[model samples]
Target chain A: MEQFIDVWIFGLGIATLTYAPPLIFAALGGLFSERSGIVNIALEGMMTAGAFFAIYVSVQTGSWVIGLVGAMLAGMALAALHAVATVTFQADQIVSGTAIILIAAGLVNFLNLTLFGAEGSPAELSTPPKPGGVSLLVPLALALVALTAFVVFKTPFGLRLRSVGEHPRAADTVGINVYRMRYIAVIISGALAGLGGAFISFNVSSYTENMVAGNGFIALAALIVGKWKPVPVLFACLLFGFSQGLASRLPFGSPELLNSIPYIITLVALAGFVGKSVAPAAVGKPYVKH
Target chain B: MTRRINAEAILVPFLAVIAAMAVGMVLTYLVTGWDPFAAYGSLIRGAVGSPSAIGATMLRSAPIILTGLSVMVAFRAGLFNIGGNGQAIMGLILAGVVGIKLGSLPGASHWIVALVGAAIAGGLWGALAGFLKVARGAHEVVVTIMLNYIAIRFGEYLLGLGGPLQEKGSSIPASKSFETSAQLPVFWRPDPFTEVHVGVLVALLAAGFAWFLIGRTALGYQIRAVGLQPDAAEYGGMSVTKITVIAMFIAGAFAGLGGAVATLGELERLQKSELAVIQIGFAGIAVSLLGRNTAFGCLFAGLLMGALDSGAVGIQNDNTLPSGVATKLIGVIQGVIVLFVGIDLVFRRLSNRIVGVFGERGGSGMVKS
Candidate 1:
């Protein structure tokens, strides 16, 4: 009985370490975009782009830090596409995000085909250096999460950003540049999402197709499960990580069934427990300069 | 003025599709470095020139058309049903199980049993989303997406070699070959040219039925009313919650039928395991959007997509382009179409003012968001 409990705890710890960096970073990215009144559903696509670029650049340059930076830039570039569609053209946020996802998928596949040809050669890339037997990225993620939580809740910039989200017109009337705030927020969101992607490539392995594998959506769930608060959101991500870790460790009758534990839990939580978590009133509403 | 606007709305989506195809042609040229004219010619030949190709195209269109309608129905009611893939998989598994268990039953009865089982499974899966939306105020988009993962995982578990539904003698992770008696029969004999089955008629019937339901039925009236304006709908004595649930149920049933058609019409048995890689359900979303969430639109859109897919196989054989490149091209075109459609309403206002060209637009007031 004691051994079982210890194993469970050990699994939870490993999960926290494995899952926290990416989840927190991506959720923080979501916070920036969403809090700024933009519905940023392209986090998944942006992360994927980042993951692809991180590995591509790292393999070319043999520098992990440069790869991470490249990943962030790639993420920003994808976000810029969303900005053009949703902000400039007044496109529907959902449709725009969906387009971005499809484009990202196509681009990745096309790049793979062009670079590796039909056989598709696997390229070796340098992993980010860790110190003191822990992934450096994990501590960096924790720090970023803490920093983001502080900025979102305590700072004046956070106040303005939240105001823009709650009522863009009102913020505009108050002389806040709503568009500028939203653009910056979304770009920042993209960069953070990219960082999460880089962690996967640099810390895990060379980018494989669909390596992000719904992690972006998982972060979105973590946002809802966290009640859109940064601290609670972090905890929620840890919970998901723990569930994932435990599931992986268990010698279940069917591994596939066991693997579905986190998703099923998330579905149940979204359906039955997350009661009417309201978004900012101005979400998905394009700020038209009347 | 309103009538003129409606006419223009109808033209925009069609123009959007043409524009997307044009862009896709350009991208295809860049990617494959092939002669554009030859590639397009091959596409046509593969899709429709040969009898077998045409038959295969029609057969492939069956599920997409139905699932596209499923998505269209839900979208009309202002819900994004991303769970089509999950629902379709569930339906497929349920139908397979029923078909195998009831193998002793007489001929057509087995087909009916399988079809009904699939429909029920899909309906239940879809209702889960509706239930969550109404009961917990959860967004259907998030819930549906999550449900998709669950469904895939569950399906993989059910279809695993040692799992329930696995073929008795099969060494692979797949269900048994459905009894020949249980299989959906081809309306026509295997001609030298094609593999068309009877499911195309069923898909057309489903399209016609969906069109009638949305256009003429009282239930559809409530659904549209709620979709257009929930507050006003409530004031008019319609239950928004009920409409949402019913709409999802119908949507799910359509997707379920799509899955059943795929299994009965094409595979005859569920093959392979690991659910994450299936593209049919997500492809349905693209079809629904490309069709502008309408019955007639879904039919044509489904046919176009099925043709592109079938043609892609031919393109792979004739050219150095990878098999997935063509499908990805279809996705790109679909994405471009949706992007254009979403911005079309805004663009039309600008174009109308700029060009002084006036015509009826079909969906001016219809696109709620």
Candidate 2:
């Protein structure tokens, strides 16, 4: 029984901490974008590119730090394109995000095939992070949760972002450059999401096509379930990670059934938990100066 | 309630398609260097050069068109129906059950029962999201996406290991063979190898039905009113809640029917582990967007997308380029098309140039952002 308790602690701890922070990081990414008035369904795409670049550049530079920075830059580049389409050209946010996802999925796969001539590239970092499958990046992601919350809620930048999301036109009138704020918020969101992707590649030997899978989407769900806040969103990601970890670990129930828990929670939450689930007022709409 | 059909409407989409194709051509040139012109020539030829090839394209299009209509309808009602995938999967699962479990029914009746059951399942699932929006103020985008995950898992379980819906004595995750009468009958058998089922007709009928419903019906007017201005719609005695629910139900039903037809018409039995390739539901969004939420627009867009798919497969089979590279090229092109479609300026500017250069009259349908 004592051994059982220890095992359970070990299992649950691994499930909660190591597995969940990446999702939290990705969710934070979604929070910045959606809270700033852009619907970023392309978090998945951003993460995918992040994972690819994390491995690709890390392999080339022989340094994880460079790989991580490269991953963030790659994600920002993708987010910049999204910003251009939705912010500058006034494209539909959802459609433009979806386009980014499609473009990323195709480009990553094509590049992998063309460059590597295989489905995945080898992990080339000499140190090759493997401390009980935990890395400094995981803790960095967790720290960022608090950091992001403080920066977003406590700082002037956060106030402007929230104002722009709530009323871009009003923000524009107040000399708040809504477009620039949205662009910055979305780019940051993409960078964080990319970091999550980089974490995935760093954990594993190579980056696989569709490796990020639906984690970016699940992270999006976490953002919505957390009501687009940082601390609550971190808890939400933990819950999802716990559920996903539980689903993946314990060998009793069907894995599919386990996988369905987070989604079910999201459904019930969205179906009116206590009050209405409200997003930022201007979320999903392109901000146009009137 | 007549929508102005401008020449810009026609020219813009055409230019977008051409530009997207050019991008694909350039990507192919850079990546594979496999004679972009020849590859494109074969792509066009494979799609329309042969009657049998056109049949194949139509067959591939049958489900995509229905799903496209599904998204188009929801968009018309001012809702993003991203759960078409989930809804379609529900339809497929329920339809599969009806097809396999319902014994001793007449052949045609059995198929009809399956199809109807699938539609109901999908409709109910879709309506659930709308209900959440009306009651809980939950955003449909999140709800639909989350529901998609649930639907996919539930479908997997039903067809997965120890699933009640699984076939008798089958170890793999799969449903039993659908009843013979349940299959959609083929119309033209120019090539025994190619499939040109009556699902094509069903697709056409569904498109026409969506057109009439959105264009001529009072319900459609209410939906459009709610979509265009929900606040104004609420003040004008229209029940925005009811319109949203009904619109979602119809949208889900269309996609559900698409799924049922795809399963019944396209294949003999359910593919056990096909969750990875079930992108048709999400792909429908692009088609609907390209069509601009119009039924006739979806029809042409569906055909264009179908040709792309068929052309990609042709490219893959002929070994003109690496299979993975060629397929990715197609995806890149489709992605480019959607991006251009989302940004109307690209097409509008090009259309303006054409009008200024060729037309005697000045044309203007540019939507100022």
Q: Name the docking class for model 2.
A: medium
Instruction: Please write out the lDDT profile of model 1 over residues B105-217, one tens digit for every residue.
Output: 77678777888889889988998899889888778887887787788778877787687767777788888778876677777654654656667887899999999999799
Worst 10 residues of 2 chain A by lDDT: A119-128
Error of 2 at A221 (Å): 1.1
The number of the candidate with the highest DockQ is 2
| DockQ for all models | 0.52, 0.63
After superposing candidate 1 on the true structure, give the runs of residues whose Cα lies further than 4 Å from its correct spot: A1-12, A121-123, A130-134, A271-276, B1-5, B29-38, B167-171, B188-194, B271-274, B346-369
Question: Against the correct fold, how does model 2 do in TM-score?
Answer: 0.94
Worst 10 residues of 1 chain A by lDDT: A114-123
DockQ of 1: 0.52
Model 2, position A259, has a per-residue lDDT of 78
Task: Return the lDDT, model 2, position A50.
Answer: 89
In candidate 2, what are the lDDT values of residues B1-369, reduced to their tens digit? 344547777788888889999988888888777788888877877787788889878987888899999999899889998888889888888888887777648746877788889889989988998888887777788888888888888887777777777787988788888778777777898687996888899899989999999989999889899899999999999999999999999999988988888888887666557654566776788788788779999998998888987887777666644467766777778788889888988788878788878653555543434
lDDT for each of the candidates? 0.78, 0.83
